[model samples]
Target: MALGSLGLVAGALLIAASSRWLPGELPSYPPAQNAAEARPAASLAIHDARPGQPARRIAEDLIAPPPLDVAGVERIEPRPPLGELGLASPPQTPMPQDWRETLLYRPVATSSAIFEAMGRRVVISGTIDVDPDRTCAFGDAVWPCGQRARAAFNAWLRGRALKCVLPPDVDRFGVAAPCMLGKQDVGAWLVGNGWAMASPSGIYGKAEAAARGAEMGIFGPPQ
Candidate 1:
């Protein structure tokens, strides 16, 4: 019994020594699978996934372009050029009423005829008709003979109903050669007939001493 007991104790020691040497049966631990690391791989597969269903179609309604409206516009008419028309006629002016009638008339009888016919037909007598030489000789000579002669001649014209147109100059004798009576050159007729002579002084200056010195017509005896 002691030997058996010794063997049993030895067997028990071997069992204890084997247990220290050998590892326990680990609770079926799956090969340390990195589940956290596998999560990224699963997420990448979902991100790269293609659309299996038909793509959603978007509805679009395009508006048509507006039509152009050009109406009711007025057009300007062109005017004809001035050169196209003929030259314009000048405007007529009215003449004066008085200018239309004649105002002058010629005489029939000359100075000689008129003088000869004095008293009967025409009479011209005044201090004016007296020669300036005869009148100047007397200091008390009244009436300016030359001036009176012109006045008498003018008066004769008035009496005859004729215009008096006296010559520019007269002889010392106070005789006008080309005296005009109503536009009639009576003096010219007298000078032409050698009855009166041309004078150097004017009709008014015929009485001057210088004019007298000329001894023109009626100043000296009939030549």
Candidate 2:
């Protein structure tokens, strides 16, 4: 009987010690009155509203827009074909290593002719110019050979166009250039005819020799 009473006392002491040391029951959270209140307003609105119309316009905006009305929209028209590409004027034939200029000549000396090119005056090339007043002697007779040579050259030109190869850079006056009249070289013709001497560095040496041998122009009896 005494041992049973001791046991009862020991159990009462354990209960008292635990109550003092352990934390009180956590404060009970108030029971949620409305389950909808616990949820977000947007979700609650969607759940509470009737199903016919959208519950929230903001939620409706998230849905992808209806497919584009391809059949109703207009399409762009294609561009017209471009006109055939062409130059304003006919293209000139290309020549290598030289500019081909067309010039009108007026004989100024036995070997030189004056012409205008790109608004500049130019003199013919490849010969030693002979003065218009120069006189030539064949045996005991003397003649105005320079004037005659000029006249002959002028007659040959007769206002025809000459295709000339002139320096890209030329002086204001006395611009010497090689020219062609049909198939003939003007300078070579002058030297070959003995009306003028070939320039020191010119290509008319053979023409000059031939003229000398034939005794043509100033080398022959005045003609």
Candidate 3:
């Protein structure tokens, strides 16, 4: 029995010695041991070890701005109500009414006539005024369109009454206003006849376009 035990012990010792020489897994270490192995002793000494400061992880060491507190921040003041500013609303002007008046014999221009009652020159609205000395092109030839336009206007007027939308009090200087010859709008007639252009107000744009398309009066051969 003693000899058998001695042989078993010898066999165990042999097995241990052979296992140590064989391939095996490498030993593992804790995180503190790993950091100590990676860094130099001088680099580790530079870190602060002051009291009251807790050791920080990589995530905690990152820079981060403080969160904003909207409720605690100062706010801008709002503007006061318009009524409390002591301002008054602007006054509106009433529209002028139509008035009937007789003309002083003839029209001064294709788009203007003299009112006999007020002796004030009223330019027909919606028509651009053409100087009496102005000329126009007709197939490479120029003609006195302005004079012809005025003559045509004079013939149409023939000392007749005009219905105008003018103020009751006459203007010291001339003013442009809508006028009617019987039931016809004088401005529309002038623009439609191609004797005058439509004003920038676009009131007679269609009429001017029609006359231009048809090549009538000044837009065509002189009448």
Which segments of candidate 1 are over 4 A away from where they belong?
A: 1-135, 138-143, 159-184, 188-197, 201-223
lDDT tens digits, residue span 53-89, model 3: 9654343334476677989998789887765337443
Write down the lDDT that model 3 would get: 0.69
Candidate 2 wrong stretches, greater than 4 Å? 1-100, 105-120, 168-171
Name the candidate, 2 or 3, with the larger TM-score value.
3
Residue pairs in clash, model 1: 118-122, 128-148, 128-149, 177-187, 178-187, 178-188, 179-187
Model 1: how far residue 162 lies from native, Å: 5.0
Candidate with the larger lDDT of 1 and 2: 2
Candidate scoring better on TM-score of 1 and 3: 3
- Local accuracy of candidate 2 as per-residue lDDT tens digits, 92-134: 3344475556554543333334445445565666677667788
Question: In candidate 3, what residue range of length 10 has the lowest lDDT sum?
Answer: 108-117
lDDT of each: 0.37, 0.69, 0.69
Q: Output the lDDT of residue 123, model 1.
A: 18
Look at candidate 2 and tell me the lDDT of residue 95: 44
Worst lDDT window (10 residues) for model 2? 84-93
TM-score of 1: 0.19
* Ranking of predictions according to lDDT: 3, 2, 1
Clash number for every model?
A: 7, 0, 0
